[model samples]
Target: MATVEQNVSEFRGIIFLVRILFHADIYREALLSRLIILTLFSYFFQNDWSQAVTKFYRTPLLYERSYLNFLYLQNKFSSTKKYKKVTHCLFDLDGTILDSEIIYHKAIQKICERYGKTYTKKLQNQLYGVTDRQLSIGVVSALKLPISVDDFEKQMTELVQKNLTDSPFKEGAERLLWHLSTSKIPIALVTNSTDQAVQMHAKARPKLFSLFHHKVCITDPEVKRGKPEPDMYLLGAARFTPKANPTQCLVFEDSVVGVEAAVRAKMQVVMVPDYRIDKELTLKATIVLKSLLDLDPTLFGIPAFKDGVKRGS
Candidate 1:
């Protein structure tokens, strides 16, 4: 019953409302806007449902939802880990493989105690993943110990010799190593520990140490810098027979320094941190596991262990 001019004026008004509804942030408003869009659509075609059906893709609500969904999918895909074809595994030796962190703590505590100071939890957290020189400096400065870095190193070496550095493997470490070795996947040991420290551990478990393709200690002639710097990790990957791209190596670490080193190398890291470490600190890793036993190699596209058992099997 409306005149042509009147219908055109109403159509323009509908278009203005369509703009507001499409940009609406509230879901309720967006839903209401959808209804309004449908009503206006009906009005525009003079209730020609057949034509609307033919052009549903041109309708704003369906198109808007599709756009929103596309944005959601894109963001979701980006947030997930992209390393599915990991070819080599690199491990941190101290806390990640050996139960040597406790031994290091004990030796440092002895040095601090000699100066009428106690090694605090705060300090231990800082030492995690640090090099021996950094450890000496931190302990000396934090405890206000009356000793030079060299002196501290002297006492630490003496103390470490008395207490065994070749401590037992951490939970599930040996099993995981065996599985990887059996699967014929290359493995490397990357550590910020001194050469003497690594030899002690390797001496204690010659057979176990043999599983590694090679070991990279910070004292290696080729190492330029220690962890929290990517130097050691980069060297470890390069030592592989065929060599590995940084993106193709998967690192397993238990300290903030190790994880950060791996991340700086642009490699994916799985963290198995001590309970004392801040959960927030471990968040930088690709994934955080309570222990090596909790990891599933297949998650990184590595071979499944025998019998198809997932954890501690």
Candidate 2:
């Protein structure tokens, strides 16, 4: 009996050792694979590995896949983190939440016409969701028009004020705003529009402005860089409570640039197409709805609807 027990103990110890070795082997391989990838990438992309590591660490990833991988690793093993609760909706005005696209185009059209430059569909599409400075710079570059940034900004501001005063809301915008307000889900206006433009548009249309008011996150020239830079969205995220994880907020946008910004911020987004800007927005947006009015309780995961009030009816 004693010899049999000794044999059994030896077998159990051997099994335990083997299991440990197996786990160690898997871990080692994973580490080695990552190292090999990093080494190869550094070698091909940069001549010096040490210099590459330093430069890479200092800068943000330029590729979407790499950024996604970084986010995955960040969320996987992080301790003492409270996930964000989805209580806020970040809206893009002009195009997404309101029907001010015509006003914007008209303003640009008038300016372009003054300079003997045409505002074509192709050009407008290229300008969607770009920063005010970027848009002005681009138009100036394209038309070879002699316009300073300051002068262009002032002119655009005047034109926007003149054109947007009576701008109408997009279908279902009022209802959406009323519902969101009643629900007490905080709504912040995140726009690439300058603060002056935001004020002008808001003054022209109070209903839209009121929905955004203390909740506004305007693209100020002062604080951070513009969209595609991730600064504005990061600022929005920072304004919320520490627990307001990017996952909790919903970004409503209408342009590819807007979608890219929200994606980098790790927020979910709904895209309302800017028909004028016919970019392939479906690729980046989480949900590409035909109209904002189409959004219902079911869309937001509010499952309290009775059969009588079926969604999309």
Candidate 3:
């Protein structure tokens, strides 16, 4: 009969062999390791050590599989931690929340046609994130149109107001806004658009627009500068009832200039740029999502969607 010490030594040997098998990076890396495992298995079975033999057969395989699964879960968790929670939400209007960029594009194209200048996609992209004044200045300068900036802006404004009657919400925009409102998240609209223009655009969905706790427009006296400058976002946050720390606020933008403005305001920004925009321009944002559809609110510590609440619906 084996002494108690001998039995303990045998159990320790089995544990050591199991550890090696479980941790092996490559099972074929060494012939000796494989030979040792096989030898131990044979010895345990020959001794009729039922428990030891069963453990030797199952423990290493189970442990190795579980360890690999653990590594996968660890990687997944680390990826999701990239986004942080925010208390207040600010949104850019034209290309971000409302599909009103097309209205702007058509209006600009009409003006370009009058000047015998083509409104190229390049020009459209370059002027995408600027305020009405900036866009007017850019258009006049780029095309050398024989018109005053104020006059050009007036023409574009008229065209936009006429065409803005039924502008649809951008994909995932309505759902996200609804979710935020339902959850009682403080939200605001910070846009380069004029207050009048914003109202015109909202005509189709006044209830949704009404959900915003505040609307800070470029035309507001408090916003001295438009995007690519932080005035608009800073004012938006300040207007919140209790006010929000810039660092605790989150901004969603669809243009490079808007992202820069949010960053300058010292807020985290999620950029959902037009597909045609250059990817390099979006790199400065805290996160770049294809659309709000890709946003996992839970990543920002907000409640995630429940079952049956489809995104972009």
Which lDDT values do the candidates have, in the order given? Answer: 0.77, 0.62, 0.77
Off by over 4 Å in 3: 1-81, 307-313
Clashes of 1: 0
Count of clashing pairs, candidate 2: 1
Residue 258 miss distance in model 1 (angstroms): 0.9
Compute each candidate's TM-score over C-alphas: 0.72, 0.64, 0.72
Which ten residues in a row are the worst by lDDT in model 2? 70-79
Higher-scoring candidate on lDDT, 2 or 3: 3
Q: Rank by lDDT, descending?
A: 3, 1, 2
lDDT of 3 by residue, 1-313 (tens): 9889768866865665565556544543244355446657677668644344344435555434433332333233346546778888999988889888888888999998998998898888888888888899999999999999999999998898887866778888988999988877899999988899887766777798899999999888877778889888999999999989888898999999999999999998988777656543665787776668767787777788664554320
lDDT (10s digit) by residue, model 1, range 53-88: 335435566655533332233223334666567999
Question: How well is each residue in 1-313 modelled by candidate 2, as lDDT tens digits?
Answer: 3477655654543353333334333453344234335644674575553454344443333322233332223222232343334667787777776677788778888888888888887777888778767878877777777787678767877887776756777776666766677777767777877677677766766765686534434456544666776667666765654435667778888788888888888887777665443322344666555567555444555333233433231
**C-alpha lDDT of candidate 3 relative to the true structure:** 0.77
Query: Which 10 residues in a row give candidate 3 its minimum summed lDDT?
Result: 67-76
